[model samples]
Target: EPEVTQTPSHQVTQMGQEVILRCVPISNHLYFYWYRQILGQKVEFLVSFYNNEISEKSEIFDDQFSVERPDGSNFTLKIRSTKLEDSAMYFCASSAGGVHEQFFGPGTRLTVL
Candidate 1:
């Protein structure tokens, strides 16, 4: 079965460095999203993208963050400078159509010290 994949399930880094979390969403899906969950906290939407432009972004998506579809299959989230509060599990998801169910990957756990 086809599934979304993320690299380095756990990433540990210092507070000032950059980090790029990668994902490859399902091949036929059209909509993509990124969400983060702090430990013991509710999952929060970060951004959603379609047709190569951002559809929606939450207040948490600040200047330090960016998303890209560098290729047909690869999606990435880059954090220019990490802060301690940036520590969280980043999940990549995709849906076949608007208002459809989103399928999620296992997630990338980013830990900034």
Candidate 2:
């Protein structure tokens, strides 16, 4: 069975530093998305990518945040400057299409101090 895989399940960084979270989705999946959930908070959508372009993005995806599909298989989210508030669990998801349910990775827990 195909599944989404993420690297560095947890990360610890300092404020003003940068962090990159990586994910590899099922090969057959098309749509890709990044979402975040602050501790004790609801899940928030960050961005969605399809056909190698950004299909949708939320207000939380500011200039400091960027998403890239570096290769055909990997999707990544980069935060240029980490802030204390950036501490959260970031999830990577993929789906075959709008009609299908999105499959999510285990998530990367980022901690900023």
Model 2: residues with Cα > 4 Å off, grouped in runs: none
Candidate 1 lands at a TM-score of 0.97
Q: What is each predicted model's overall lDDT from 0 to 1?
A: 0.95, 0.95
Give a tens-digit lDDT track for model 1, residues 44-101.
9999999998999999999999999999999999999999999999999998876769
Clashes of 2: 0
Question: What lDDT, from 0 to 1, does candidate 2 have?
Answer: 0.95
Worst 10 residues of 2 by lDDT: 94-103
The regions of model 1 sitting more than 4 angstroms off are: none
